[model samples]
Target: MSRRASGPTEGAVELRGIVKRFPGVLANDDVDFSVARGEVHALLGENGAGKTTLMSILSGAYRPDAGTVSVGGAAMSFKSPKQAIEAGIGMVHQHFRLVQPLSVAENVLLGAPSSFRLAGNATEDRVAELAEAYGIRVNPSAKIWQLSVGEQQRVEILKALFREARVLILDEPTAVLTPQEATHLFSIMRKIASEGRAVIFISHKLDEVMAVADRVTVLRAGRRVATLAIGDSDKSELAKLMVGREVMFRVARGDHEPGAPHLTVDGLAATGDLGLPALRDVTLEVRAGEILGVAGVAGNGQRELTEVIAGLRPATSGTVAIGDRDLSASAPAERIAAGLGYVPEDRLGTGLIPSLGCIDNVMLKRTDEF
Candidate 1:
């Protein structure tokens, strides 16, 4: 574990000798990270490389078995997320924590200490001003459920800024955004950094890191591999540092003819959670031995369409045919019996029980055998 030289004026946010251990895994091994004031630092790693765990410690979600956290050149110990927020550290998780029924302003002020004293319109006005200043396009009065995924992300940022966070951490910030929306978010991050606030961006996409980050730190197998300035490093070098070897960016594939349609949807229409039109006359067909990707921005009826096809959501009008059988009106189990397998987005909550073992979870779909 290599150590970086640290001083009282080292950076706006700094972690020295961070070490965290799970049941049998050393999640973080003496990792040292720092972000200067007005800097955008990117944290890059492969899956299970201990990036999230390291940030969780800095955000007060977990205590480091060994290390010191400092913000604004002062040593600090955070026992909870609130403590971290109060000490100028705030984190927006990949999975948003906004309440669906609440308006953007309300969600931003949900846990605020002065929320009870602030007038409703006053809160909205303040939120609007903040949004405008940061160029974050969002309606403060709009309900979370009514906003697109990008808009919801803005609300999360607004919440952190409203709390006066000087060190903002975004975990996989662009995971659900469209290309245009992601560009807009990058602009917002730059604006925040320009205002003398530290922005720690955690992502797996090297292209985004190169595009938006001033410096990046790579972690591999619970250890810090390297930290380099954007100008001094390239994607290929970063990839090598992350995985300990050169990576192939391209693959050659042989072309093959697609067979007859295996699954088909005709004029599918469904309503969203708010009873608003989500899928409007959507139609598509999937051929055998071929992959059909449903590409769109989030909250564009993708979930509703999938649910309707799996018989979890009733379609207002449509026909879903698996092979030659019409399974539009069939139950989920019936659809499963018809050779249709569905993997929901919420894997832990909907697809399987977290407390159950793998065998028990798999047996959930084969209960009839018992």
Candidate 2:
């Protein structure tokens, strides 16, 4: 087991007794976290475990309702995201924020301080240089829409590094990448930390946390549970800390024969929101009383397949049938009426209305039946 130290200073960024609240929940309660320069620190938690809220406070997206945030040993009170950036803190959110129509270099240079004048092609050349340094290769002149999800992620990391962020926060950076791409990203993170910069990444994947982070701070129910060195901790220990329970990492799969197809999709074709071809001639079937897993690296038509089947997206060419009822041309309502219960991946927006109460959200699906 190997451990690296940040040298001199004990921590580069620190939070003490941080507290934040929403209308109905204590999002963060007297939580404390710290990361050191020249270290890759991982923040781990389950969903709604205050990981995002804590990072938001650190990045100046949300001022802490209470407590203190210090950067490079100096206390900080950030008024906006810009303030955080100026303080050498940069966060790449789980969702990409780049403009689709903008060139890679343009997006990297967006909102840069205009006080410093650059020679023509200097910005592009610098972007290229940073890309090469980080092992991220992308065409600087190409529009964001032309890049793959992995490539887009590279651009996000490059943008942060270009801004000279001393403390870089990446939220679920591998959620959209293949195993190979994730490995590459881990290498880049090591390079960044070795350069005397602080790298804080939010992740739920236990394997990644163990592999990339030198130290980890686990959050549970909006409070800090434990901060331990990677060499001393194992997956079972970390999982227990995150959930406050002994978690079973594996499930027993009982054998059962599959019945007739409950869901059938044939020759599905679709275009992404950018009007680019996403799915092509995909065919699959899920039998009744059996589980079917669609496994792939992210952004490889999995979302399109689900949307087309749920009638949320139009299929350019294909047929979808649920237990003999063809839903290829059906609207979402029609599909719902035909015994399709859709729970979208985005829980706040498409899955349920945030403003509406639970009763009302339930009624939204059965209003016609009522």
Candidate 3:
């Protein structure tokens, strides 16, 4: 049941012939993995390739039907996420799990025992100190709701670092980061590993993996296909490993000829559950052959404005017109029929169905348009 890499590294965690099933699909089958301590291992795979599934098992969010997991030569079975967390395994999801109403420090120290809570100036002081120490900067007393996307991420990493996590797992950490922020994070990662903690980084960015990983494990269709050292892998080679064979990283587009507005919005407003207006009379329009980019620092009126336009959420007062149709009274499905193909911004939790296949998702889009 055991599969071995060419050589062993210290602080090693091993998984042998793991198998997991969920109703119609076998998510993992005879999967094997080994990660050395103090090393940054990059997990590579396509969307449904079982990388997330395997990590979920390791993080104690799922259990393997028939397999063995051993850390430092000791066999262990985890029945829950808490059990795994207690065993020094910490996971930061692609989308963070922070409470927006809470402060940065509060979000970092949300779980764990009661004796850890701090108030007044001490909590803020410690959080600021810890964040700066890791090269991850943030204002501790600032509410999570106000922080930028990158800042929130720093807080997320701080959560694991503050816990003294020996094994830190980050999923798609740099997906939304600016290039500068990404570089900074990689530097911090190296320093963390230098302290003898294992880091498991899951990402689709080939260059980042090659840049930051000590070794790379390629998973395809729920199977471990290859494990290669960083020195032995290239972006093209790694991309092929994740997706099988080759891929063309290009998008097809036509000439940049602009046209009139297909949809228009002005003075739109919507209140949240707390009765505060989330969107405050925003105005915008999208034209044919032109791409309108909404630049914001996150949690602005972007989502609320889009929802109002898409007919998902009703606006308190405003004009939303789809080619002069005045779609303020229309439904979400109606907006699509009027030539608005909303791909949505949130992929997980709000958009993608975890259980569905690639083909099935494509089918959904086609059926919706038809």
**Best model per TM-score:** 2
Query: What's the lDDT for all of these models?
Result: 0.88, 0.89, 0.81
Candidate 2's error at 309, in angstroms?
Answer: 1.4
Return the TM-score for each candidate structure: 0.82, 0.93, 0.77
lDDT of 1 by residue, 54-128 (tens): 989988999999999998888989898878888888899988999999999999899865633368598898899
Least accurate 10 contiguous residues by lDDT in model 1: 1-10
Write candidate 3's Cα lDDT for 1-370 as tens digits.
1112344368557889999987877888899998888788988888878888888898899999889887667788999977777677788888889999999888878884445567777767777888777777788889998987888888888887766677888888887677888888888887777677888889878988888888889888888899998877788888888888887777678668778888788888897656778888688888876778887545556777777788888889988998878988988777877887766777766567768898777677458545
TM-score rank order: 2, 1, 3
- The digit string of per-residue lDDT tens for model 2 on 39-150 reads 8999999998999999999999998899999998899999999889888998989999999999999999887666433568898899998888887879999999899898
Question: lDDT: which candidate is best?
Answer: 2
> Which runs in model 1 stand beyond 4 Å of their true positions?
1-10, 21-26, 99-129, 139-146, 240-246, 273-275, 353-370
State the TM-score for model 2.
Answer: 0.93
Summed backbone clashes in each candidate are: 0, 0, 0
lDDT of 3 at 110: 85
RMSD of each: 4.8, 2.2, 5.6
